[model samples]
Target: MDKTTEEKFVTLLEENQNIVHKICRLYTNNRDQHNDLFQEITIQLWRAFPKFRGDSKFSTWMYRVGLNTAITLYRKSKRTVQTQDFDAVMFRISSEEYDDTVEQQLKLMYSAVKELNDIDKALVFLYLEDKNYSEISETLGITEVNARVKMNRVKKKLKKILNP
Candidate 1:
């Protein structure tokens, strides 16, 4: 936590904030839980910063840290679950551009994702991010074949949720 490292940390966070946000959205149900996850991911990334060797793309590094944090983080208490990260970062989106049915379908899909297991959620998140099977396998230390098969299963699970 020296000043120089702090500066680099800020730069790092600024460069890859979107990865954290995407992971949060896929894994959590609401603004509060998502923000908690966002803060936790930020902290995890900062702690693991010294280990980053630039051997891979920054987004790849982000996937490792963000997914690790999300899978491992647990609630300290129900009352303390909400976090301030969302308030700290301002992202603008226009919901009005979408019609009501589209919005409803989007919400339903998010709700379905929220019900999946941790590893399944990770698969769904990667697929939603448009990551290739090879990239996801590298990030998760699995074979590309396994990644594709799991993605298929996650897709079927989500489809069942939407239909049921």
Candidate 2:
């Protein structure tokens, strides 16, 4: 709450904001929704900053808070039964750099990812971010073994969705 703490929070948020953006991208279907989720996550993080005891890495803590915020929003939105098309260009891959085949594959993969349940989506997001099983378990409050099991299930699920 003090100036020093506020400064530290700003610095940390600036350094790790990509983590927040990635989570938002996975959870929201539009630019407006993405910005709303990002702002809400920032508010949640700021509110919880005072209680952050540093028991885990700052980035790890950010992941926990960010994912929880996203999941909560996702559940609330689902209760309203609103459905939107997946943004196929979410990754903004340039066609100049990659061939149409690769771009199409990425789009299909992202579309499949969007179809996953909230927890499964979080698992895939964390996996893509290169988080180890321990970190994924810690972030999602599951055992490492459970994380592995869920991730395997999620992968197969994505495969089925993409192929079917």
Candidate 3:
């Protein structure tokens, strides 16, 4: 990449890297896998950067590419275990003051999200990020109506998991 393109990519990526992190966190089971997936997504984004038209918000385009790369690259594995490392430094919560109830609830929610299939997880991720139905449809290449329906179903599934 030229210096100009490199600079642009870095600026855009720095501003929106949280989107990639969220996808990585939702898709990967452990820190190692998350880092690997994050690298892969970054590479894919760089390769596709030149083709990015200015039609949509950069974050929207980032979500589309990041989610696609994650779903394609990370869904081949069939791991059933969900492992999360909740270090105090990572979560900004002091170890001595950690709340067991909050930790347990967080673990339960993460487990429930981990149980969702690849596409549903993407939908949920976008939904949680406050992406609208149209943007979700555009990112996932589904109809806006379908996005709404699928989001409703994902919410119900999450509720069931939490309640059960």
Judged by whole-model lDDT over C-alpha atoms, candidate 2 comes out at 0.79
lDDT, candidate 1, residue 117?
82
- For all predictions, the C-alpha RMSD in Å is 5.6, 7.9, 7.6
Q: Write the per-residue lDDT of candidate 1 for residues 1-164, one digit (tens) a residue.
A: 67787676677677668778777766665667766777777766766888889888778879988887777664344323444344543333222121234346567777888788878777777877888988888788789999999888888988898898
**Which parts of model 3 are misplaced by more than 4 Å?**
79-105
Ranking by TM-score: 2, 3, 1
Task: Tell me which of candidates 2 and 3 scores higher on TM-score.
Answer: 2
Candidate 2, residues 1-164: lDDT per residue as tens digits?
A: 68788778878887888888778777776657776777778777887999999999999999999999888878887622233333431222111221234335466677789999989999998999899999999999999999999999998998899788
Candidate no. 2 TM-score: 0.83
Candidate 1, 114: how far from true, in Å?
Answer: 1.5
For model 1, how many clashes? 0
Question: What's each prediction's TM-score?
Answer: 0.75, 0.83, 0.81
lDDT at position 25, candidate 3: 74
- Please give the CA lDDT of all the candidate structures: 0.72, 0.79, 0.77
Better of 1 and 3 by lDDT: 3
Q: Clash pairs of candidate 3?
A: none
lDDT of 1 at 48: 87
